[model samples]
Target: GFCSQSWTGLIAQLCSGISIVCWLCALTPQIYLNWRSGNTESLSLSFILIWLSGDICNLLGCFLTNQLPFQKFLGIYFCTFDSMLCFQLFYYRWWVKRRDSQLLRSMGFSDTSYHHHLAPSSSSPDGQPQAGTALLAANYNNPTAPDFFEGPAASGANDAFSLLDPSSASSDSPIIGRIIAWVCCGFYITSRLPQILKNHRRRSVEGLSLSMFIFALNGNLFYFSSIMLQSFVSPPGLLLASLPYIIGSVGTVLQDFTVFSQWFVFRR
Candidate 1:
């Protein structure tokens, strides 16, 4: 019994260490891709937001439920990094929009008149405009033109802006945030569904960062393993309490793997 307990403890420690490393590195790939691409359109905002919400919930849950010190630390770290990613998404979106507006202005096209001037004419050859020309005009005049530019042209310097007001954080009730955090925990668990559906609908993972999901898979696997190992050496009651977290990590692993598979299959 002593040997088994020792072994389980060792495994738990190793898994937790690995999980932390994976979590730390997981977002780097996505961050690099966003910086390189200069557009967050391909990356699902909902996914990031939901993940952020989840991290908040995870942090609070750990604190409320009296999880291990390391687990609580991991939650804090995850929340911090998740928030960074969210901020990055917001920054990239704003930058792309501003850049597009500037380009339109440089071309002497006012937002109001741009679409009107570029609209397809009825008197074109064969009483129909060329498909390519019409598409190009439509893109230029589209209010959400930034959504289409997923290339290097969309890349721009980072902008610093907070999505939420500073005052809100300072003045808002802690109870409200805590309530939202619990809600976000649920959001976190289900957040991947939309992304999976998106990949299926598009049949392409063109804009997704492959490394991001790969790292997520690694992190989640280790996270689940650590928890399971710890639970193995603990009371049955502890295991029952940890079931939700275990399920969450396992679910995340499966979803992340599905996404990684999509990346592989769709890359062709």
Candidate 2:
């Protein structure tokens, strides 16, 4: 429908475009944060990997169903971004530490010194307990301190898992596409839990970026709006066709709010 004849259609397209922009841009902040901090310890690897898995399903589902070109493009874009996040996690969690370990060995310091140098102190030189260190260092005396004490958590997770609109599986598509769409929904829903649990277990969201989830919330809201707007003016089947995407976006929104609440409860 042309803009002049169908305002709803026009608005729906506008919302969809906005959602694409938001979703594409959402992961960059977290990636940059990880790189800047020289670590991804604040984030959960499972969350990113699970989201990447969902994007793979979304892409395959889109291709199998012969969905819109842009939908397929979005799927590819999502997988690529998720891969980048995964690379950052590897670099920070494994590569960087390995590099440092090698350097420490070259300088004749053992692994014990490496750990000692990287560990944070529970108190400042002035003798006051640092706000986060005391709680994070509960196992400081143990030789095998847990990873959470390695550093403060990052300020965010990419709703990157939720970015793909798995709704590309229209009613006319094969049953496989619809099944994959639902599977993508499950991945998106399950992806957030690990990070939330990480935040809860640590009782801190110090380094996690609230902005990442904020962008995610906005993206999902607009994505859902576009689908609903289209459903209102299009045939009733349009609603059914878009069900998986609707559920994915809505479920992520509620989970995003849950993450937001965690921020308040655990903000340092």
Candidate 3:
């Protein structure tokens, strides 16, 4: 029994270590995708905001609950990374909008004027469309016309995933942030719902990064395993304490799976 317990403890610790490493790198795939595509429309701002809120809460909760020093550090790390992702979203949104506006301007088109200019007109005497009109008309008639000129204005995923720490509330903790932290926990749990629904509604997952979610899924699985193993190896009371974290990780995994399914089912 003693040897088995020790082995289990070791395995848990190993899982936890791997999870920590994963957390450190989890956002890389998504970041790369956003950078490569030069778009963040497929990502949900609400999802990012919710994840940020959760990270803030998790950080505060760590300090409030006096969790392990490493956990506190992890919270901080998560916040920093989450902030980068948020900034990426902001940057990409602004950049894409600006670029699209420039494209429209270069094309001598405005939102109001585009329809008017591109509308089909009677053919010229040569039985061909006018010089400038032909190209624009062809582009306008093409299925991908809107995508080229307008960009993916409506292609973001509407959900996000974040880890939550429930043990943040404590008698000694400040009331304000703690309350916010609790709210963050709720946000983290439900953040993925919108994205899933968005994918279902659109019947597409064009803007999402499969690698990002895959990394997230692996990270969460390991995180949950570590927590559950620790709880098992520790005293009975520890299990109850770890419940919230477990739920957070598990919920994230489920949502990730849902998103993955959408990717599989809706791939173009």
Better of 1 and 2 by TM-score: 2
RMSD in order of candidates: 13.9, 11.6, 13.6
lDDT tens readout by residue for model 1, 180-219: 3335435645677667776666666655667667666666
Clashes of 3: 6
Question: Residue 265 of model 3: what lDDT?
Answer: 72
- The TM-score leader among the candidates is 2
Each prediction's TM-score versus the true structure: 0.67, 0.76, 0.70
Q: List the residue pairs that clash in candidate 2.
A: 42-154, 153-207, 154-207, 154-208, 155-207, 155-208, 155-209, 156-208, 156-209
Candidate 3 residue-wise lDDT, 36-132, digit = tens: 7665655667667667666666566555555545555666766776777777777766654556556888987785564344322333222211121
Ranking by TM-score: 2, 3, 1
lDDT (Cα atoms) of all candidates against the true structure: 0.50, 0.58, 0.51
Instruction: Tell me how far the alpha carbon of residue 39 in candidate 1 is from the true structure, in angstroms, after superposition.
Output: 1.8
lDDT at residue 153 of model 1 (Cα atoms) = 7
Count clashing residue pairs per candidate: 0, 9, 6
Clashing pairs in 3: 41-156, 42-155, 42-156, 42-157, 158-195, 159-195
Worst 10 residues of 1 by lDDT: 135-144
Q: Write the per-residue lDDT of candidate 2 for residues 212-261, one digit (tens) a residue.
A: 78777787787777667755665556556556666777777787888889
Q: After superposition, how far is residue 150 of candidate 1 from its true place, in Å?
A: 45
